[model samples]
Target chain A: MGIRQVANTEAPALTAAVDVRDLWMAYRPDEWVLKGVNLRVPKGQLWVVMGPSGAGKTTLMKVLAGLLPFQRGTVEVMGFRLRGDLTPPSRRVVGYIPQQLGLVRGLTALENVLLGSLARHGGLGPTLGFFPRSEVTRAREYLEMLGLGDKAETRVFQLSGGERQRVAIARTLMQDPKLILADEFVSDLDLPRAARILETIRGLVRERGLTLVMNLHEIQLVQELADHVVVLKDGKIVYHGPAGTLEWSSFRALVEAEDGRTGVAGW
Target chain B: MAEPGSLAGKGRDVNLRRWQGLSGALALLAALGWVLGRMGFFEPGRLTGGLVNFGRFAAELFPPDLSVLPVVLGALIETVEMAFAGTFLGFLLSFPLGVLGTRTLFPRPVVLAVRLVVAVTRTVPSLLWAVIMVIVVGLGPLAGTLALAVYTVGYLAKLYAEILEGVDPEVIEAVRGLGARRHHLVRYVLWPESANTVLSQLLFMLEYNIRSSTVLGLVGAGGIGFYMQVYISTLAYSRLATVLLAVLVVVVVMDVLSAWARRHYLLDT
Candidate 1:
């Protein structure tokens, strides 16, 4: 299928959907979590961030999503430059799916998806539970697109893990985001399900020309789905290029390499 | 090569240690008994004498004077109204305080200030509050209602803050990531998730307030308790028995209703 570009007034004519330059972050004082990390992701591409356990893949995603504050460096996402603080206005064009699939267990799938348009319906609309019929219809359409039309009335607690993940994706899609950051969004799903989810994500990204950056541990899945690949090790970028450019053996070696040895345990 | 006498000596040492432990326990028990006796807790003479007098009074309480049934029912209805009004007011006031007190929503200083107010209010019992209100508001159901409302605000707010704090952080994180404001976080995420728990706690507080409101009138706060005091002072055992029976019936009905509400409405089951 040819790439379909939807004109967005919010996003400028910028090629890079995400651009990070020498980013640095730390949870504690002096000790850094991300040290001198840099990346540039073009629009309409599915990028995979591959790393071992505690290799700062999630941290980088948070920094890009404007969830975590950085001690140093610049981050530009969805045409907004982020220094440290993540203001609500700057976050409007982004959709973030956390590792745990943060769907409210008590709310139905439709209600959960409707929460994505909360910001759009500002004032007392959300507080009074008054959603315009158009927004509700759009939410249902997103669920239908995600193959959850029949399960719209089902509470999230009653859904399986894979189903919950799909619900989370539908919720994100309802946001109408320019960039989507997913952290291990399908790690719990089986191979066929994972492949199907990736396929759906790929189709959406291409159809809408939305940038997709996700953290994945499965190398074969990454090889099949990722248009671009970034490998992080000890808070540094070990590899960043087109996914097809690297051999499987070399990519494995790059991920397993231990460069910095401080005898510190993985976070 | 060990001597037989050495093993026997070890056994003797064990026996001595066991005896020491037993004596230590005995000393502790004796100390506890001496303290309790000094506090006048084990006075069998006064207890037996009081029981004999109470048995005489109990015989007089039978065949309760049905003549005062109407008056007793009116006071009983007033008591239920006080409990219901107090619990409703408390619930209304506690809702905002609970939301503001959550550390996830507010800063540490703000959360701490809200918690300090809740703690101070909760430190005083509802009966004590009624007494204080009686002094301030002066002898009526108004005093009882105000007392219960203040007391409920303290307890319910603390309970709500705890529930808000215990909510899964990831759920909040997801909402916040979507650019949801503070109010949205509360209205959409926190309240819906904790609604069942909050409803259950409210019902429990209502049941407890009903029982407590019955006694608020002893301080002239207005209820059957004032009539009870009057009957006892005038040595009117039959009237007092009628009042006690009315209270028993009201409390039982409230208990059953609250339990039903909890099971059928608040809980999933």
Candidate 2:
């Protein structure tokens, strides 16, 4: 009773943007992909989830995005608890950038970015491929912020991998969500390009006071940018702490341990 | 405990199967040849006689009856109208039926039922559909128009279903994550992704309906084919030639226009 009271007393010291408690998820019955996981991100911070292939990184992101239903425990994002019945928070509250970037290949970069503003305009105007002039101007501003102002009319299929990644970030920014979830959205780019894009995303997160949870394999970028880090292996959190506290050698050993046990490749 | 020559035995068995397959194919070919012979397909005298009769008929069809130009033009207009109305009506219904038929959008039972209906409708030829409509609507352009519309619904529904089903799943997931409703998916994802193919298919269907509408009038469904039936009954070969010429000209023009429209509006390049 004394410990419970103490825990309750300290709960208000930090406001949590994402609070996940004892979460369990699976695609099939009795075959768990995420066994037991707990995570917490402060109101305005960038958190990186790192793991080897098939370590439930993508699965965790999907759960947080409300794309997948969980079997056990509670997941609360932006103060609203996610329902076990697969109901998600309002789309305006959570922005998700999928692994493939999820930009419509046939649509222009501007149109794709404008898709982020869909939840804001519930009228028939946007439904018929029409957007308010102000929204269009804002979408252009987002593109310009991402250095894609010149290519706004270019189709997504015509854009390079790095360019496509920037467009996706712009789209997410246009969502005006308090929380952003990205799943390996930049693992394909070169060092310079990835860093440039990461800087843009990190800048926005700081300016807007948005909480970000991204899945990445790059320890260098994670060390440089992430405020907190969570290392997952086989659906379990092996390490969870502030980014500055974890040593690079120990983090590398934890990620590389599974490479010898299973034939799966690791970073 | 295996036989010493089992490998050799397997080789012989394979060779025997190959010989059996070759013999079966030869027997099928011989059967086909015998049927063709019985049907008089190789009779030289029958072929020569047919050619001679065709030549004589062709001789009489020349200098086609120019006096029937006004009649042929009016019938041509009616045929075009029927095709246009039918295509428009079919497009209106096809989009919804197509959406319902897609497995990605609806449940298995719903998709199966919609596909079954579309399949049964498609199984009946457009000409037969026109005949049925003529019986019900008492023989006019309305029957022809309804027939083409029904055929278009069956044809375009299946096409639209396949196109919608083929939309990139990742795009759909992303859009849904944005809190897009079903109508948003249709208008934004499905429609834009498949606009070129859908437009091309619609134009092709229009062209096909125009060509087929010429035959609807034979059943008194009000098109140029009515004049064809009249020409045949009255042995007016010259007038028949004129109608054929008009149909040929219209078909060529429709083909060219369809091609141009597809290139200009549908293709990205």
In model 2, residue pairs whose N, Cα or C atoms come closer than 3 Å (at least 3 residues apart or on different chains), thus clashing, are none
Reference-based lDDT, residue A94, model 2: 93
Write candidate 2's Cα lDDT for B85-144 as tens digits.
999899999988999998877899999999999999899999999999999998899999
| Residue ranges of candidate 2 with Cα displaced over 4 Å | A1-13, A244-252, A256-267, B1-59
lDDT of 2 by residue, A11-64 (tens): 543878788899899899988888788888888899999888998999999888
lDDT of candidate 1 over A91-134, digit per residue (tens): 67889999888889888999999998876877898778878899
Model 1 segments more than 4 A misplaced: A1-14, A244-252, A260-267, B1-35, B43-54, B267-269
DockQ, every prediction: 0.49, 0.50
What value does DockQ give for candidate 1?
Answer: 0.49
Cα-based RMSD of the predictions, in order?
7.2, 5.7
**How high is each candidate's TM-score?**
0.87, 0.86
Residue B68 lDDT (model 1): 96
What lDDT does candidate 2 reach at residue B161? 97
